[model samples]
Target: MISTTDIIISICYIAFIVALGFWAGLSGKKDGAAAGEYFLAGKSLKWPMIGMALFATNISCLHLVSLAQSGFDTGLLAGNFEWMAAFTLILLALFFIPFYIRSGVATLPDFLERRYNRACRDWLAVVSVVSAVVIHIAFSFLAGGIVLETLFGINMFTSIIAIALVTGAYTIVGGLRAVVVTEAVQTIVLLTGAVIITVLSWWKVGGWQPVMQVLQDGGQLDKLSMLHSSGDPSGLPWYAVFLGYPVIGIWYWCADQTIVQRVLGAKDENHARTGALFCGFIKVLPVFIFILPGLLAYVLYKQGHLDLEVLRQADGQLHTKGIYSVMITKLVPPGLVGVLVAALLSGLMSQISGALNSIATLVSYDLYKRNRPEATDQQLVKTGRIAAVLALLLSIGLLPLLNRYESLFNGINDVISHIAPPITCVFLLGVFWKKASSQAAQYTLWIGSALGAGVYLLGKLYPINIPPLMVAFYLFVVCVVLQVMLSFAFPMQHTAESNRLYWESPLAPLRVKGWPGLANYKVLSTVLLLMMAVLYWVFR
Candidate 1:
């Protein structure tokens, strides 16, 4: 049962997000009904809105609940998912963003079609829409439902419906403008709520020093170590963490059309770059919010003062805490409990709004517009809004099925890691390698994705298990190797016309002008270096 105080806080939060949506709706209408104005916010987002929008869409309930579970299981080392992402962002800044902006494309699939062929575009669009609607949002909804049920003693099904209805109503009415504006507010609430929880956790656990001391006493301080002396027999291997993490991040930040679209839809490349950089910076904060709480949980367990019970063996090997419930019922107070609930909901809200808007854009622009080139802007917008409503219902329907996964964040990551690498491979090959042909691109994508899906399934089903991340890399390698062989065997049928066609398009690769002066490169590099050093120092 949600306390009345938390319920009140949640209501206030809903009102705030809806109000922002209304504000965006008002502003967006003043600009009239052009596709650019309604769907892309007139391509006028400043740095702050751009930054927060990107952050909001990227960070979801997975961060709040799934990431917390990872911390409980692996200590600080579990943060490889969040921290290793910086390298991918750097790659985007250096390579992908400039070319993407040059393309002047509204969506990633639009680039695919122009770069390769209609087949590539249509195939990728199918995959992208399915993944966004069925996999990403559904899995996230499931995870959010789990957190809601555990935290508030509410029915998971009810929570799922309620969240979907609220998110869908706003997104359907307001389009991208509402999504962006609401995302900004959601990001602020999420950050503030997390800080409050972290501060309170530290205070209750006798501050930073005593928290460490308790962890030491429990003989579980090794949880904080990034490097495992030996790979876990059951859990993700450390080598996979090192390589797989970066690969997954590359797909998400640079190649995942949903994420890159935010940058692409920016007013210009500079705004895109700045927004991405700000998101990269904000990405560093997960350790403080999610990971620290897991460490605090360990401290509470060791001291025998924890509000949640820790199951244990006769030999005293640590077992799982009811992580979802413990994080809420144990760590938070009454009024603040509502605050954290809102934080969890904020994650859910950002992801849903983003998917609703993006899926609609793809359906309207990439699919419907391509087929019916003569359709009016109003027709396209109406179709997009209808698609959003349909997608929302489908996602809400899947929330109940999400309970089957062991770890919510890990499950979603595992699924995305498989599907994403193949797409990323094609995009990278298409842009940088001028010789890449539609035929070669199509073959590589099919062969690579088939191999990836097969390997991932085998890893899951077989007793001699392999990590999903490793399977993704193995598939990536196979695809690249195959693309090279095929390229040699069937050289691209590049003609003067095709070359001209590519060059005329906005997304065509720019001739490398004298370095774009990555303003934050050194700062990001230093931060990554310090993080590595600190981890090694503590573990050593």
Candidate 2:
């Protein structure tokens, strides 16, 4: 049970976050409330802040709780998502950052307009906004509500509302500046809480060898491996990971509005590039701290170190939803349990705030300002605030429906697998192949979206045996074929601006000069790539 001290600590931490947000908002008034100031934090973010904000925004309690659930159910296998993200972030740093920075666009849709046409921009803006709502905000709310309910014994929807209102109150007023400042602090707290749980669990389980022995004794030792071959029952084989991950990873890491908006706020291209690479390094932690706890829970239970009776369900299966909270209550001592609660709330609030700010940007820039090109800064700011409020309300309403998924982590990726292919294809070809036409991209996004939805509906009606990763790969293949053929048929009519966007050769982006010493993006990217390879090799 949570003690009185725990509740007080939790309340105090939340109040501090809200106050910090209010301070960030009030501080920004010095810049006089320009649209750029509100939407992109005046484009003044440095590398460290941008990196932490990016990581914090991408992660939610969904990651802490559901990832632990995945670790318990599977093993190190679920780390594929976390690990594969490094490659995409590297892509963002080396190739995508220059275009984003040089073009000086507020939203990705604005980039689409400059690269393709207004039709492309308009379509992408709608899709990006919907995606920010569904993928980023709604799922964060769902996972957060589950965590809050587990810890406080409060009604799930009630806790969600209370948290959302608090988070939104500051986010609507403060914009990206408040979001990122709060996120940087939240990231530190989140990492510390995760470290506490992991260290405690690790000590309780008697370290790696015992955990291995427990799994080996149970005859499920395959749980220890990070990579699997084609015949592995996990369905996500090595080849599928390589082929399928890039499809969704490109969309999530490189092109998604919510995730990429932090980079958009960078003080310069160097900051944007290094910030993304910095995030790549941080991605290495989730597999250890977040997912490993669940594996530890499994190992500890097998060794009779943990009692998981509360996780038992009426249908004779484990109720994995509350597993992380169970660990907090069981293993963590009283005063510190508040730290864990605060950390969970940190993830929930940071993720929602980041997405809310991105929604506001997309609305103000892509939806509202474009239509009213003559709109004042105040008008655009007001429009964005309204959009953020509406977006939060819509996401709250989606919680009950999204709560039905058995595996929140898997369910999220399954939805992304269907939604991401066309956008990924468009961005990839538009940036790499100068021959890619505006008409072709517009048509590909339109047709490919319908095709993916149709496939999803068909899967529901029929027994489709393919894995979600493989499904995404196949959809990407079809979309690529359609875009390639259409591009050939329609031939691009690139202006001087669009011509600067694509490179002359594969090595072109690498030839550009970066910051001096080890901080150079090329240097950092190389080091990160080597580090990831070593990690996978050791875990393999």
Query: Any idea how many clashes model 1 has?
Result: 3
* Model 2 steric clash total: 0
| Model 2: residues with Cα > 4 Å off, grouped in runs | 30-33
My TM-score estimates for the predictions, one after another, are 0.90, 0.98
Range of the 10 consecutive residues with the lowest summed lDDT in candidate 2 = 25-34
C-alpha displacement of 78 in model 2, angstroms?
1.0
Tens digits of per-residue lDDT, candidate 1, 173-236, equal 7878888888888999888888887887778888878876866777766777666654674356
> Top TM-score: which candidate number?
2
**Each prediction's whole-model lDDT (CA):** 0.73, 0.91
